[model samples]
Target: MEKDSGKHPLFFVTERLEFPPVEYTNEEGLLAVGGDLSPERLLLAYQSGIFPWFNEDSLILWWSPDPRMVLFPNKIKISKSMRKVLDSGQFRLTKNTRFDDVIDLCAQSPRKDQHGTWITQSMKKAYKRLHEIGMAKSYEVWEGSELVGGLYGIDLGHVFCGESMFSKVSNASKFAFIKLAQDLEKKNYKLIDCQVYTPHLESLGAEEMPRENFIKILNEKN
Candidate 1:
């Protein structure tokens, strides 16, 4: 039987675990296959510019769209207001601190005009494992003793692959992102993988690069 003919209607699993070419993904870059979110699978997926995203009860969906959105840490724009916040030093920033808490908060926090979340329970557990193994890291913004905002993602070689972020206070998420970019810059990290497009990310200096270009960069550094 043809490979596509035997695959699950909504998903597929590789017989020997190989990803389709990034270009073979649909217009949205949703390429083939569903596999467990084993650490090895997650790492391989990300390294190829694919990531798992799905709602509860659905099989894991992997994607790697064309015109990928990314941020070069040194290229992150700091607006006047954000610069003021940074200058004030009102919030304390820490790395890999309370990561599980940060992920939980992200899952619970509501997005404006959106019901539910994509950060399913299984994903949370998977990433938490990634964190424990030091492949994933969180950047948290704290107000006094409270954790107000943060983001998390895998750190593969020279890439900081952003998965999701949430803000509990105004500009909190932005601040945490700024700090992440700054720190990544210090570490000589190559890119902040935003995965998809968003006006908010554009305002912060993220731009689109073709998927092929992205994979080339990723592979070059790996």
Candidate 2:
């Protein structure tokens, strides 16, 4: 990755696209921005530690920021309250079930201090396509046959790039996340690409590292 000083970033047309160096001024990681979110491009981006994150009206912005946030499957912290909730057995967890529903709920569920959502319709369509191709998966939490909480993400070789998650019932999403961590660990997955930082994720033992270090881990696993 080399710093690009050009006025506008280049657009990559091939499956394998190079990301501009993180040393550039933009913390946004605006590397080679505009491109269609074809399955090929999405797969290549994930494999190269790049991801698309932009609004509906914006161009397909690709990002590979300097400080990457990630979580190791085995390192997820289970709070005492969450453990009790899991033990209660009020909700059942299912894999690859109601993925579109999960993403929809994630987009609709309101955060405490936020309005609107980052998961636009176009993003939904792209990820749904990824799911159809088996590159993405969702975990659904069911309470007596009703979908209450769930999460979705892209699953590469040994990494799960989490997109978004939502919970209608208390601790439902957390329970699903814990199950995901356990399942991924059993399958020998190395890390979870969280994309950005949040206090909720930090409480679950996510940590931030330099982007170079994160890419090193990705390359090592590859």
Q: Number of the top candidate by TM-score? A: 1
**What's the TM-score of every candidate structure?**
0.93, 0.89
- Give the per-residue lDDT digits (tens) of candidate 2, residues 54-154: 77777777878768889999999998888888889899999997889999899999977776877889889999999998999999998988899999999
Candidate 1 residue lDDT tens string, 1-222: 013643332246654466666666766667765678888889988999999988888888888888999999999999999999999988899999889999999999897777898899999999999999999999999889888899999999798899889888888899999999998899998899999989999999999998888888888763
Off by over 4 Å in 2: 1-25
Which residue pairs of candidate 2 clash? none
Q: Could you tell me how far off, in angstroms, the CA of residue 87 lies in candidate 1 after the best superposition?
A: 0.8
| Model 1 misplaced regions, further than 4 Å | 5-11
